[model samples]
Target: MREQFPLQQEVTFELARDVGIRHPQVSGSFQVMSSNFLVNSFDPALPKFVLQAKYAKDLSDPRTVEKLELEQRYWEHKNVPWFLVTEKEISRTASQNIE
Candidate 1:
């Protein structure tokens, strides 16, 4: 039988500490089920990935863009796939079901 590993959600990483920095303001918040989904894999060969969700209109904001870039960089440093998910990508039925 194959060993099963459950997917993890809302994973947060301490970037400053990992990179040998002690900056108080430098932190990473990967919140899932609302704005982002940080999926982790127990298998060493499998890479972890992130799914960030945002409204179509919100994507145009400068702050949002900056946040997205930071997230992309964080994932890239770890060699993980980062995906953007907009409201248009989510089905109404599925959203309702989740709610």
Candidate 2:
């Protein structure tokens, strides 16, 4: 399951679906909160990856850290991974420069 901002919801969902399809035995869903995807793999005892999307600029922001902490606690409660997907700084800066 996957969900980013309203603008990237579809794109992120597609990505999550692609990942899910690669693992036929896995089953999970996109959460409404911090986690974009919650995957439950075949190994029940292993820690699952908790995918989240964020912008490059937000990476060093205090709010981003807070959100990460919250996501960690939330996913950890259920024993999940705190994987984050952030835009590449170089690419983002290049794009900004182009503009």
TM-score of 1: 0.57
lDDT of 2 by residue, 1-99 (tens): 454422233443444454442211225754433466665567767545666767768878765565465555555555556677666534767768868
Worst 10 residues of 1 by lDDT: 1-10
Tens digits of lDDT, candidate 1, 1-99: 111222223222344335443322324643331225767778677656677777899988876675566566566765778788887998999989989
lDDT of 2: 0.53
Badly placed stretches (over 4 Å) of model 2 are: 2-32, 42-47, 89-99
Say which candidate scores most in lDDT.
1
Candidate 1: the clashing residue pairs are none
Prediction 2 TM-score vs. true: 0.47
Per-prediction TM-score, please? Answer: 0.57, 0.47
